[model samples]
Target: MPCHLILSKLADKCPSAVLAVLDSLVEPPQKTVNFKPKQDAVKQEVDHNEDMIRSALRAIASLNRISGGDCNLKFKSLMSEISKSPMLWDKYYSIRNE
Candidate 1:
């Protein structure tokens, strides 16, 4: 979020800088794996991975609000995927409890 704040402050003066930061916020897709034997371990790993993705998407969504493009759809799509997961929306909000 600090990066989001810094980028937003720079956005008014330099939109290109904002776009660059937004573009970088998009993380590469993680490789899909199947771990049938260690179900709990795999679920933990997946939750952590999805949290990372959710974080990036949240930042991107914030940037999209300031930048004003069709990019919100992209961020929303990934967010929907997270919502559809077994872990649901809890992991995304769980950090706030801390």
Candidate 2:
């Protein structure tokens, strides 16, 4: 998870400098599929994506704080998505360890 995303949600009162540092953490090495929104209205979907990212970062940080260890990137990715929806988080966690 990106640090900015974690800080954005956990400490909304954080300074822009923290935001800037978080921004720098987003440089992932994985290849991504380019998504093209068909309409400007779909931009909200993009914003949601950003929100999801932020949420997940928060969740990952929370998980780390709770577990006291580094979460694998794959687990962090799943944690991020799960954080966005409580139902999904419960469902995922239920099935994840099985």
Tens digits of lDDT, candidate 1, 1-98: 35544544565567666665544443332111111234556777777655555554444444445645445454455556655765544654453243
Residue 9 CA displacement from its true place in model 2, Å: 14
Candidate 1 has what TM-score?
Answer: 0.37
**Best lDDT among the predictions, by candidate number:** 1
Looking at model 1, report the run of 10 residues with the lowest lDDT sum: 28-37
* Candidate 1 overall lDDT versus native: 0.47
Q: CA lDDT, every prediction? A: 0.47, 0.43
The model with the greatest TM-score is 1
List TM-scores for all candidates, in order.
0.37, 0.31
Which stretches in model 2 have alpha-carbon errors above 4 Å? Answer: 1-41, 71-98
Q: Lowest-scoring 10 consecutive residues by lDDT in candidate 2?
A: 26-35
